[model samples]
Target: MSSPSTPAGDLAFVVRTIARTAVDNEGAFGDLDAVAGDGDFGYSLARGFEIVLADWDTLDPGTPDEFLKKVALVISKRVGGTSGPLWGTAFLRAAGAVKDRTELDAADAVAMLRAAAEGIKARGKSDLGDKTLLDALIPMTDALEQRLAEGGPGAGPAELAALAASTARTSADATTSMQARRGRQSYTGERSIGSPDPGAVAVAVMAERVAAEWDVRD
Candidate 1:
């Protein structure tokens, strides 16, 4: 139940969480993507994480921004297809938003999420309700902001992250009924209605991991 309080620990947690998720749920994501996409989304992300895992020890323990930039570069280079660049851009933008911060508080997390959302939208030319990962991410950010606003003056990162995870999961599930308006799935139009976007599910999984791994801290 130990929680991360430093830049290196935080970066390590993200690496471990994503790698574990890729291992446990890659096939599931592939199956979901097959319904509308090329069925490689899962494999692509997993490969990116494999690169991340291989170079884990080399990741910067200095600024959070540097650590995230390294991860973003790995994803951009190792992962294939649109997801690679878009996800990489998201992380890169988020890292820029955080600048040289050594540790993230609730506000820093929210800012990073906001920057990530904007990055995804710009990189993919998509937005909320687009039946993409943005669907889950937008609602998750909204929920986190709401939680931070309503959790009173002493609002903690754990509660905000938990709310983000819950919102992401709910939004991801709701994507099953949505029609694709962006990405490879858009070619299917209404055919994507029954399957949740794999990217969205991936986002939800990441959020869930963050909540589970760091909620004990605050």
Candidate 2:
């Protein structure tokens, strides 16, 4: 909001927002996952992020990369099931993208997101059109990067966030017709076609939350 003042501050805000979103939407997420998966996605994510919030004051904030790595360690160790490794890897890769950078810009943001998506793709052995989170995440990142590149009208932070959120939502909704190709949902075969991928929906929801609160975040 109002252009981030510091890299550390921006990372703090985004992480806190993500953690809180996970905690707050546990029931909805769990219900979504139950359609095809084991229904533990929300539970696992909330449990891990709860620890993140509980230990917020203790997490290193000396630098953006350091903070993200610390968070990644916590996620990998505390989160259960597949969510742990995938999400942890995402944070780790994002941290690497900004390694030693004292400040960040729009390009840094794009790079971090790209790194995170690649990490998720590798860790989950999934890709776009796999009916996974990447379905939403990658498209969202591309939209943001493209918008920034175009520098079109209303290409500010809030607008870019809104664009990303919208793209993620659209992409997630499109997963409803796609048969699952990865994760527990794949076991359901055609049954997974009617329902959206929980991970994709989760990504969309988180992006939406971030966009809606972008201007108001401290």
Candidate 3:
């Protein structure tokens, strides 16, 4: 499997990976969500991504941003629960970040992630340390940006992705110590402290999958 060399190809690879991850981990994600909130996170995510996969052949692949925007529409419209709006907003903002760009570099990737984080923050009315996915997403983005800034030898795409994935996993784990301040889990207050945020865990899992499979995607 050859790696994608173009922006469109790269976007396709990433979206496919995320969709597959969500679909494959449905039961696990639902179980994690059950520990805190209602066990619908996995179902909502899988349903949304299932639509994406089902409509893969029909979505335009002319540009990365265009593809992402279409995906956002699908997620927002087809997915149920709060997951739809939050994740859809993330993708929409990401698409906006790179609008009209013919190509993308590390900086563009960081910018897209930042935009997505901001979108999530705005849509979910949440922030870092809220025991939401932001806890993992923000740190992962920061790690990627920092790694890119450092720019040492061998700090390529795969290495940066691995670093982000590691950061996401660690940050997601840290959420176990934080009481949920947002979302349905917040209703349980201190009870949410013992379990990590399902959204954060999902982000970590997806990042890990992307990193592990980066070299093999085409």
On TM-score, the leading prediction is 3
Clashing pairs in 3: none
For model 3, give the 10-residue run with minimal summed lDDT. 1-10
lDDT tens readout by residue for model 2, 56-173: 9887655779888989999999899999999999999999999998787777888999999999999999999999999999999999888888886898777877998999999999
In order, candidate lDDTs are 0.82, 0.89, 0.91
Q: List the residue pairs that clash in candidate 1.
A: none
Q: Candidate 3 residues 1-218, lDDT tens each?
A: 11387666776787889999999999999999999799999999999999999998887655768888999999999888999999999999999999988787888889999999999999999999999999999999998888888888868888888898999999999999999999999999899988899999999999999999998886
- Deviation from truth (RMSD, Å), model 1: 2.5
* TM-scores, each model vs. reference: 0.91, 0.95, 0.96
Task: Tell me how far the alpha carbon of residue 95 in candidate 1 is from the true structure, in angstroms, after superposition.
Answer: 0.8
Question: lDDT of candidate 2?
Answer: 0.89
Lowest lDDT 10-residue stretch of candidate 1 = 1-10
Q: Per-residue alpha-carbon lDDT of model 1 for 124-205, expressed as tens digits? A: 9999889999989888888878777777754666666677788999999999999999999999888989989898899899
